[model samples]
Target: MPKKIVKKGKKSHKNKPTSKKYTKYKIDGDKITRERNCPRCGPGIFLMKAKNRVYCGKCTYSEFESKK
Candidate 1:
């Protein structure tokens, strides 16, 4: 008989998705919202919103946010 192996101190991150990674545009009373995507990578790939820029993880394309 083979003994079952277990990994210790590892978090089960696969079960839950991170909320910070997703953001959708809201309208007056619309139930449907669209997610922002990277222009270089098309609609399938999303852009990462950082402190100062929006970045695409796939093609390394980045655009800086304008300062107000």
Candidate 2:
């Protein structure tokens, strides 16, 4: 005879995020402009842009939008 074993919690099935690095730059005429960078992290580090704010992944610095 064997005792019944129970499984605990269900595992998360979240999808992996995609890379959109190539979309970050803009080319207009002869000028090239890029997205904003993290103030705390300086030039090389870029801020992640969202619908209402932009934030830094490394430093966790966030800036929200102002209410109109």
Candidate 3:
């Protein structure tokens, strides 16, 4: 005799919303907001600020200031 297999249908979980929260950092007025270009590297380089100096995703570099 062969055993019977049970198949289940897709379940719905629409009640929950899928969203992501990104951390944002404040930039000072003196902080220069220019298109970052790595001199050592090539073009298409940039950086993102999130409460502090972040690194260039493409270059993998980070910048930060020390508070005395």
Candidate 4:
């Protein structure tokens, strides 16, 4: 067996949620809104908001932010 190659470039990380689950919801003039949900995992599963990307822990799915 040989040593596995390590890919270079963007790194992957696991960041804990900064706020409580309830804080993820918002109320605006009687209208309720919630954080974006993971498309791959469907509803009831919220996506974790990072500085530049949104991630899904259950399926390791991620989306990067576009540079302005």
Candidate 5:
């Protein structure tokens, strides 16, 4: 005797709910305060916040060195 094969449709997987969910960090406007130093840069280097990266105030160089 041969066993019967079952064919699944597209809706089979689509109907299943996700096991994990993603959450983002939220900042409180009233409680949160901005720091002067750049988080990306290590200590001893004084950096100022630029558009996206932090720039070293003393050397006038960006904390994120350009690749290549």
Candidate 6:
């Protein structure tokens, strides 16, 4: 018996929402709010701020917070 060849389909991204359309920055009276993005991935990707470090889930990038 001969094996049948199958063609691969187009690449697909996960069903979850990848990026938010709204600005990450927020305004509170006279103050401005914002989120830090991943340096390696550029805009649209935000880093998760932890107690000691900031991390990016997409590229596994992280930076430790400096002690002051």
lDDT of 6: 0.80
Candidate 6 residue spans exceeding 4 A from truth: 1-27
Summarize candidate 2's per-residue lDDT along 1-68 as a digit string, tens digits. 79788887888878855556545667888989887888999986777888999888879998886769
lDDT of 4 by residue, 1-68 (tens): 99999988776777967666666688888999988888999987777888999888789789986789
Which segments of candidate 1 are over 4 A away from where they belong?
Answer: 1-14, 18-35
TM-score of each: 0.51, 0.53, 0.34, 0.53, 0.27, 0.54
Models, CA RMSD each: 5.3, 5.8, 7.6, 11.3, 14.4, 5.7
Ten residues in sequence with the least summed lDDT for candidate 6 = 17-26
For each candidate in the order shown, give its overall lDDT on alpha carbons.
Answer: 0.73, 0.80, 0.52, 0.82, 0.50, 0.80
In Å, residue 46's CA in model 5 sits off its true spot by 2.3
Select the stronger candidate by lDDT from 1 and 2. Answer: 2
Tens digit of per-residue lDDT, candidate 5, span 1-68: 79788876665455545431111112467654333444445454546556676676556667554555
Q: Show pairs that collide, candidate 1.
A: none
Specify the poorest-scoring 10-residue window by lDDT in model 4: 16-25
Total clashing residue pairs per candidate?
0, 0, 2, 0, 0, 0
Off by over 4 Å in 4: 1-20, 28-31
Q: Cα deviation in Å at residue 37, candidate 2?
A: 1.1
lDDT of 4: 0.82
Query: What local lDDT does model 3 show for residue 54?
Result: 52
